[model samples]
Target: MEYRSEISEELEAWERKITRKSSMVSRSAKRIQNRINGVIPERLHSIVTNSIKTMVQGVLVGSTYTVHPPKKNRSLQVRDQQAKELIRKYKRIAATEGAGTGAGGILLGLADFPLLLSIKMKLLFDLASTYGYDAKKIEERVFILTIFQLAFSSDDTRRKSYRKISSWDESLSQIEVRKKYEEHDWKTFQLEYRDYIDLPKLLQMVPGVGAIVGAYVNYHFLDWLGENAINAYRTRMIKEENQTT
Candidate 1:
């Protein structure tokens, strides 16, 4: 009986240690997420916002200028330039002390950033493709968007998001919500605008950097998108607001 009792006590102690270790890991992850958010600036948020706008414009142009290669060419160049600028701005932000210095540090600084960008790009690419844009051009846009996403984002989370966004099969038979703009039956398209499109739009309404991160994630990441990314962005924005205020 005494031996059994001692064994029980040892098991309980081991469990307690495991629980403590788990708690520490959770806390550390949260702290790391918070730190990453703190490093990204409002300007990076603005870049996200601007990228969404550019994407929207691209969609509109792609829908209306289907046959005109010259016009499409100009529009594509403009969008590309804007995307490049946004990437540049993001790089500047990532280089700061808040964003961390070394590769590992930078990875830590951009935990959720890639996810947000991936979501945004997925939405934009789908929208453009649905509007009768050339498949090659759509693919090009996807590639460019992915590059921009990677330029500003680091970490395993971001990389995974990129892979998810890149791999999304928009060809699946799903419902479509934007009937007026769509060429095919709503039922033919496997995804509804609300699922892949409007959700991103709603996220864009969030104020300041929070909306930016939310919108980016909504448009780019798809299934890989997580609330944790938005939460991390919000926490960082709050910290910045507090510091400035």
Candidate 2:
């Protein structure tokens, strides 16, 4: 009977160890998953900005070639070549400077993505005002974008922003905000700004603007999610304690 009891105790101890190991493995897996999910929004942001920039370039080049033909004079040809070279030089500068579309993407990867976002948003607002977009409209758009970001953030870290925004006692639901912004007419949206800042112009304001916005938003959101998750786990613990009592 003693030998049988010793065997049972050994089995129970092994089961406990296995349970602990399994729990550790599960936690580790979740941490890794969270890290992986955190980076996705940043990548998406870069892609969206890049696509917009490419479209703008196509429109600009097509309009230049189709709407205004260069003069046929030899002197004009020489001037045209020089102008082309200058454009190339400027393009290179834009690519490297914070004023380029790629700059936004690059900024997203940096450690200071949030700072970059604030700076870029300010710059864009100024540019919009200069172009003639109404100040109120510009502010509204910015707020809309911020809210859209909070709602659509795929990064586990930025879930905090989602919670904060969601918890607000406002008349606008998250879905409503997203729909309102999305349904806004593109022409009206652009016209609302005082300045006629095209995609390239807007992007050039912040180096790697796409990436910077993505990363910062993602990181912030994920942090919120992490906190909420912890709270949820603690609640479960409390519930278990109450049951025991």
Candidate 3:
């Protein structure tokens, strides 16, 4: 009971973080980012759209990351500890991959985008499984993408995404989630992610700076995602427990 209470406190703090309002600086930055995106050519946008679509599609259908079965019932604290370990391992993998590609110049720097995305999706699935969630479900898969959006979106978008994630289980039945999976706004998903990450990742294409930038960005991005995923799942778990009790 004490352990559960401690976790409940941690979840409360995380809830505060995800629900906080956007600041002026962040709003201004998002405005500038939108302006910049507006100036980019449509041809390039189409190309990027196709690329992201393909990458995400491959992961969705691929069996590479689905080997692990969902873990059985465990205490929230035990699940949290195991999730931390998974994050640590994936962080190292992302950093190493980033360094290698970043050192290889423009081509390899571009390659890291999809590679890192794949790694992130895989880790999210693994963490879901660890938390006893069925990763194979369409709703669960879409939830993974929602968590990704929460990590990479601007403040306004973050708030919207957080609401969806917070009430996800209540918003839709399993049948509804599965039936409406194809209705997800994937274009918006890809664009927001690209826009949010473009600056740092673009810098990773430079010859001398690419290597360092790549390693640092990948490491921190994975860390951010890991934290978000943990909190998202924790919130859901706590809510479910409350209902049952």
In order of appearance, the predictions have TM-scores of 0.23, 0.21, 0.89
User: Candidates sorted by TM-score, descending order?
Assistant: 3, 1, 2
Model 1 C-alpha lDDT per residue in residues 1-245, reported as the tens digit of each score: 34334344544453243223235764465466555545657665444445444443354344522322222333322433443444444433433322121123323323333334334444334333322344335433433333333323334324543443334343222233123224433221211222233233333444443434443443343322212222222222333435687
Name the regions of candidate 3 deviating beyond 4 angstroms.
Answer: 55-64, 174-181
Which candidate has the highest lDDT of all?
3
State candidate 2's TM-score: 0.21
Name model 2 segments beyond 4 Å from true.
1-111, 136-152, 155-245
Better of 2 and 3 by TM-score: 3
In candidate 2, what are the lDDT values of residues 1-245, reduced to their tens digit?
A: 34334444544453243223235754565466456445657654454444333332322223311222222323322432443343344333322333233344443333222233333333323322322233243233333243323322333313443443333333365467545545545332222121112222333335435534333333443333222322222223333435688
Q: Is candidate 1 or candidate 3 better by lDDT?
A: 3
- Cα miss at 241, model 3 (Å)? 1.7
Q: Report the Cα lDDT for candidate 3.
A: 0.81
Which consecutive 10 residues in model 1 have the weakest lDDT in total?
186-195
Q: How many clashes does the backbone of model 3 have?
A: 0
Which stretches of candidate 1 lie above 4 Å from their native place?
Answer: 1-44, 55-140, 161-245
Q: Mind giving the per-residue lDDT tens digits that candidate 3 earns over 1-245?
A: 78767777777787778778767886787788789888988866776676667655554554545636789878888999999999999999999998889899978876787788888988999999999988776677778877987998766788887898888766677677545545656667677888878888888888998888889989999999999999899878877888899
